[model samples]
Structure formats: structure tokens, C-alpha cells
Target: MASPTTAPARDASREALTDSPPVDGARAPGRRARMPLRGHLRELRTRSLWVAVGLAVGALLGWALYDPLLALLTRPLHLAASTEHRDIALNFTALGAPLDIRLKVSLFLAVLVTCPWWLYQVWAFITPGLTARERRYAVGFLGAAVPLFLGGGALAWWVLPHAVNILASFAPEGTSQLVNAQDYLTFVMRLVLAFGVAFVAPVLLVALNLAGVVRHEPLARGWRWAVLAAFVFAAVMTPTPDALTMVLVAAPICALYFAALGVAVWHDRQVDVRV
Candidate 1:
């Protein structure tokens, strides 16, 4: 009874409905396919732009504060020189050595200042691939890392003058000992880096335990070997062979290991409760 025109419209509507896909059993296209390499590259470029900005800012700050930074870094030498009536002079074999050292120091300061930004960029890039639990762990470790590194650096700053004194004691009287600025800076940098890394050992161990990669009992059993290894690391990394420096480095590592063990034990207990 419908008109011919109405019948055609109805037919067209039915055809369209039939041709359209059903939602229940249909699968959406993957994110990877929907956004291809070009899109990914564009995102990466944006992130990199931000990182570059941060580095540039850090470099500017470093350049502005170069004199103060140099003074702070040379404090140990200054203290030693004052005590021993000696001078710490920076010798330059090359014509550009002094300028090069300044530029290098500026770069180092910039990198140090920009570390958090750089770390965040790296974390942001990788975070999309991590699960919720992994993200939690990453955040936890990062929160712990700042304090641990600061503690280590503070310890180094406190002990370094004494260590310098011990080393200067070996020089003969009236010789007018001179320590090269470049060499002194390198030594201080190495010591600070070594201690900072050592202090974070516990956080790493606890993370491994939480990931189920290592267990409490094995770590507890490995204590003897761990202590020995700590001593070896101290001996190798300490700038001086002085017993005080060696013990100062080793003691913290031992403490960190035990702290890690305690964390592992607690984690194991929680696992037992869950089971």
C-alpha cells in the first residue's frame, strides 16, 4: 500500500543498516596502526624540543654561576693549601687548556642541573609501555634516589677535606706542593659519583626483589660475599688508599645492603600472608 517513492526510501534505509558493521563482535584498529611512524616521530620531536629548552636554560645558569661553582669545587684544595702553606696551581700544557676546562666545567654543570628534566623525559617516553605496577615502582625508586644521592654527596663533602689532608701529609716539608686544578676537580667528581651510585644500591636491590627477580634468602646468604665485594669496590674507587676513606665508603654500602635485606624480608612476609 506504500507509495513507490516511500518504498524506495525504506529499501535504501534497510540496505544502509545491513551494510553497516555490528558493534558487539567488532574489533577496533590498534593504536599503532591508527597512529603510524610519522605521528610517533612528531611526538618525539616535540618532547625533544622541551628537553633542549631545559638543557639550554641549565647551560645559561651554569655560565652565570661559573665563578662561584669554581670556588666551591676548589674548597678542598684551598683548605689543604692554607693548612700546609702550599699552592694548588692548574698547569696547562696546551694553549687553550684553561678555556677548555672552563667550557667543560660549564657543560658538566649544565648536565648536572638538567638531570631531573632529562630523567623525566626518558621516563615519559618509556612510561607508555609500562603497566600500573611498574609505574608505581618507578615512581618509588625515583623518590628514593634524590635523598640517597644527596646523602652520599653530603658525606663526601664532609669527609673530603680530611682525605685531602691525609694525602697532603705525604709530601715532604718545604717542597711547596702544588695540586693541578684539573686533576683535583677530576678526583672530586669521581669520588662524588662513586658515593652517589653506591648509596642507591639498596633501592636497586629492593626493586629487584619486588620484581621477583631476586629473593630474600639468597640475598641474606650472599651477605658475606656482598661485604667482600663492597670492600673491593671501596679499594678500587677510593681516590686514596687511606684506611679512613676506604672505611667511609665501605661502611655505607654495608649499611645499604642490610637495609635492602630488611626490605626484602618484609616483602617476603607480605607474600606469605597473601598466599
Candidate 2:
């Protein structure tokens, strides 16, 4: 025969036990559940392994296609030599230069070929932290970034002949230019990467706006400076004396900037409405 007070206390204790979640499922009070450091490390390792495998496979493909790729890259140089009426030679000066070039180019191709996969791995790693809206924005940006980068690279390749012709035309009369294969390839890679990164800049700006790190008004106000900067960048990159080539390179960049600005403005309006 338990006392009335003891019975009430027993009932309360049983109710509490029944209402509480199991230990394995329970989260800390007043906080979102988080993965442990070890779990994060494991996840990172797994993704890194996958990325490495992808690069390896891409490298094999690049190795197989090395000759065709090399020919494609040097076609511009040959075109420039022909157009400028200059005798230009690409020579491997060092004993192991050919092997080195092959390896480097293969690695570069691997990176380019496996870009989408690695990018997705990166996205997957960071996605758990993002809200639904942020994930959508990230996906959109990532999709745009790859195509824009590739387009920029293509644009650089298209302009390469003109740039080579202009630069080679500066050589003194009766001097046959002997260019190192390694140095020329390095120059080509740098130009391609620079153009790719530049094209991706607008996407970054739009992303910042969407993420609330920047506002649309400031970007809109700086259109004049942006246009000037674009032309200057184009001039530097193209290395052509004529304004036409510079305009061709700058026009696309200007268009992308304005497009990004428009997106920012639309996003801001949507945010305001929500607010």
C-alpha cells in the first residue's frame, strides 16, 4: 500500500521516461545536431579517394589522346608562324623535356576532364551545412561556372593565333624564332586559366549577392569602372594593337557582368518581398 504522494511521483517518473527520446537519437538541448569531427574526417577521406580515382582515370585518357591534344594546342602557333611569315620552331631543349611536357599536359588535361566530378564532390562535402535555398543557388552557380570557364578557355584558344602573330611580328628581320616547348606551353596554360577565372568572376559576384555578402546597387553603380576594367583586361590579354580584338574579348565580359547585375537586382527584390 503506497502513499498517495508516492503513487503520483511514480506516475510522473514513468511519464517522463516514456516521453523522452532514446539516447542514440537524442540531440543536445537547444542546439542543432552536428556530426562529430571524426565523422567529418571520414567523409572527407572518402570523397578525396573518389576524386583521386577520377583524376587517375582521366589522366589515362589524356595520355592516350596526348598527340591529338598537343597538335590542337600548337595549331595556333603554326597559324601565327604562317600568317606572320616568320619561321618559328618549338623545341625541347632538355634531355627529358619531352617526357616532362607529356606528363604535365596529361595532368592538366586530367584536371580539366575530371573537373565536374571533383566539383560535385566539393559540393557534396559542403551541402549538409546549407539550407534548401542555398543549395539551389549553389547548384545553379556551379552549373554556370563550369560552362563559363570552358567558354572562356575556348575564347582564349580562338584568340591565341592573333596574340602569337602580334608578339612574333616584333622579332628582328632574318631571325628565326626558337621557342622552348615548355615555356610556350606554360604561357598558353596561364592565359587559358586567367581567362577562365575572369569569366567566372561575374558568377562569383552574383553568388555573393545571393548569399547576402553584397548588394545589387553597388555593382550597378560601378558599371562604368567595370566596363573600363574589362577593356583594359582584354587589351592586356589579347596583346593585339587593334581595338577590334580587344572589343571582342571585352564584350562578352561586359555582357556577363550586366547579366549578373540583373540577377542580383531580381534577387534583392524577392528578398524585399519576403521581408
Q: Pick the candidate with the highest lDDT.
A: 2
Which ten residues in a row are the worst by lDDT in model 2? 24-33
Candidates' C-alpha lDDT: 0.78, 0.88
lDDT of 2 by residue, 1-275 (tens): 87889988999999888666545324332112267778888888999999999999999999999999999888877887887787887899999999999998998999999999999889878877666566677889989999999999999988888888888889987778888999999989998999999899999999899779999999999999999999999999899889999999999999999999999999999999999
Tens digits of lDDT, candidate 1, 53-148: 888888878878889988887787678878878765556656887777677677777777787898798787656555556767789998888679
lDDT of 2 at 221: 96
* Model 1 residue 199 distance off true place after TM-score fit, in angstroms: 0.6
Error of 1 at 275 (Å): 5.2
Give the backbone clash total of model 2. Answer: 0
Task: Name the candidate that leads on TM-score.
Answer: 2
Per-candidate RMSD vs. true structure? 7.0, 5.5
